[model samples]
Target: MTTFDDRENAFENKFARDEEFQFKVTARRNKLVGLWAAEKMGLTPEEADAYAKSVVQADFEEAGDEDVIRKLLGDITSAGVETDDAAIRAALDAKLVEARRQFIEEA
Candidate 1:
């Protein structure tokens, strides 16, 4: 193969790996936010775990984080938790940082 072809292949592989890493990080962040919301809603430990998984799955409903945030806001408010969109967004941002740190540590 030509040198150009080899470099192209390497770039493609790096892009794929980076995308996969980002997906994992986002899912981990979703789970962390889910656990945080569950605690705010006073869920049991088992329920919290399940809720976290559900939050991770919620991401599939849309392209961005809006779907997960909507679900959490609805559920939290329905459970009588006093919170707002800004608060949830803040938590999501914080959880994302934490999630990235956790993944980096694992790597």
Candidate 2:
């Protein structure tokens, strides 16, 4: 193969790897955030696990984090838990950091 072709292939591979890494990180963050919210809502252990999975699936509803945030916020309020958007957003940020750290450690 030509040098240019080889370089193009390498770039494509790198892009794929990066996309996969991002997907993992986002899913991890969603799970962490879901657990946190579940605890705040006082869900049972089994319920929390299912809730976390649902939170991870929420991301698929849209192209960005808004869908997950909306789901958590709505659920929290509907469950009569006392929380605001600021707190949820803060949790999301913290969980993202934790998720990235965990993923790096695992790698």
lDDT of 2 by residue, 1-50 (tens): 69999999999999999999999999999999999999999999999999
lDDT of 2 at 5: 100
Ten-residue stretch with the least lDDT total in model 2: 80-89
Give me the candidate number with maximum TM-score: 1
In model 1, the clashing pairs are none
RMSD of 2: 0.9
Q: What lDDT is reached at residue 35 by model 2?
A: 100
Candidate 1: give its CA RMSD in angstroms: 0.7
TM-score of every prediction relative to native: 0.98, 0.96
lDDT score, residue 67, model 1? 100
Give all candidate RMSDs, comma-separated. 0.7, 0.9
Alpha-carbon shift of residue 10 in model 1 (angstroms): 0.5
Model 2 segments beyond 4 Å from truth? none
Clashing pairs in 2: none
lDDT digits (tens) for residues 51-79 of candidate 1: 99999999999899999999999999999
